[model samples]
Target: MLELDEKFFSRFGAEYSPNEIIFCEYEPGYEFYFIQKGRVRIVKIINDMEKTIDVLGPGDVFGEMAILEEQPRSATAIAMDSVRVLKFHRDNFDALLQGNPQLAYKLLLIFSKRIYDAKRRLMILLLEEPNVKVMDVLIMLAEQNQQFDFESEITLNTTVRQVASWAGMAESEAQKELTHLARLDKIELYEDRIVVKNIRDFQRIVASRRKNLYSS
Candidate 1:
């Protein structure tokens, strides 16, 4: 999906099954990858629970930060589906980029967007309300995945416990807000997923709470 040159397909392409571990956190960073198909989940252990911080689709890049900093991986990458990716090793990465100007520009654009996204997530963490944090985390994921819509139902492949971990709150607190949202028909909770009745429904509540954060 990245419009990568066919020259690398045969030489560097790799395939993975669903639930396969691409790399683990703190491991040596030998290479980075760009998704060619399906999805990859970027996870980290937060409050002793594994949480999906980012879900990457085709054309996305992961494991680059480690390569850049010459350090261990910051998070774990897992295949969420039968996925295909093009792997780039650190040794040859410079040569490849020097020869492929177009590829370098494309990757620069993506890295810029990732930085902006990180800033927005930091703002979400600044909010004091546990409930708003939960809703904002959902909003953040939906927005990142480009799946948010006011009139359409979207099922987030996440559970209350995962949400709590991402939001840095207790699981019980996240579940309570989820149940309240379900009572209002804003969301439908399942064992492993939460179907957002309308993405904008949660958006409105999150915005309103932020507005009243300094109010009496």
Candidate 2:
């Protein structure tokens, strides 16, 4: 890793709320990477629809692709949770390329990983059935935690607009689904977080919509 000045990160550019977009107008800027905590979803507006390009969690990085290419940002990045990210200006990249070959190589690796994950997400999005896709999202979250406390609730800080972008659905459809699920006692809204109430019930929904990938 290249030497980074911690003091330089005092402000961290800008802060964001869950589902709050960081770059809406898509102007020229520096590349940024979240070194602290939380999740971020990179999105793009296409055909008047907000489409999620990728989901980035802690230790994950983004925004360098545009800076490297000397192009405008291809998409918007929204905070999936309250987040702090370190930004690297174009000058910083220029310096690294000129003075630190190792750092330059590291940036390449990060870009590769981002591309790989984006491909996987695109394939998953192609699957038919909204129910199945939604179930997959829940299962993915469950696996992220790797816990099975039926009594405990797992809350996600996301909105219908954000979930719709992630699931390739209309915002209204996503809202309807969420409302239906909540009415059926499958989930509950606890403040800003969406809580999965009955874990077993949610699992059954996932199992019912399970595809071949769920098999051993």
Candidate 3:
């Protein structure tokens, strides 16, 4: 987890919860550092269709763009579950970043990582898994949440719509794949998590999808 200094937390506004819309497309809001105990969804709507672009969890931070540039949001941020966040206004964030060089560097690094993840998403969209992009999203989630010393059970707290948006697939299709995976004994659903039964199987599916894209 990215540790925030006392100064940052002290100056932050109140915490928020699940299902709350933090920001809307083209709207302005304070920069937020969400320590997601559950899940959060980043959405972008285009041409009248809603697309979920990212599913975030613990240690994830967003809303930096608004504070950095004093510009409107390019997308919408919604809490997918009961969540905790540290919010800072643009002025406070600017002061913090300017005074603490290391903190600024860390924030920049986080930004770079998000850019990298976005590039990976573009690759998945352009080069592979035309129909199974949701699987790719699951694979990414598995990588992030996989248990150590056990090849089984990656715990994820996300919804079908969120996964579908990340994968650029329809929600029904994403649901179908989740069911199929459960039937295949690759994963199992719990009350609050999707337990990955076989990480290798999911990885193999993602690899095969990538290969198909490369060869096509």
Model with the higher TM-score, candidate 1 or 3: 1
Which has the greatest TM-score?
1
Tell me the tens digit of each residue's lDDT in model 2 across 1-216.
334466645744456677777765367756656445678887778888667767877656677765657667777888889976766666666764676576577778887866765664564476566755554555445544646465576776656665666677777886777777788777774445577766666666555545444552
In the range 80-109, model 1's lDDT, one tens digit per residue, is 999999898988788978877777887889
- The TM-scores of all predictions, comma-separated, are 0.69, 0.54, 0.62
Model 3 spans with C-alpha error above 4 angstroms:
1-23, 28-61, 67-71, 77-96, 127-131
TM-score of 2: 0.54
Cα lDDT tens digits, model 3, 125-172, are: 764544457666766766564364336556677777667667777768
Per-prediction backbone clash count = 0, 0, 0
What value of lDDT does candidate 1 attain over all alpha carbons? 0.83
Residue 18 in candidate 3 has what lDDT?
73
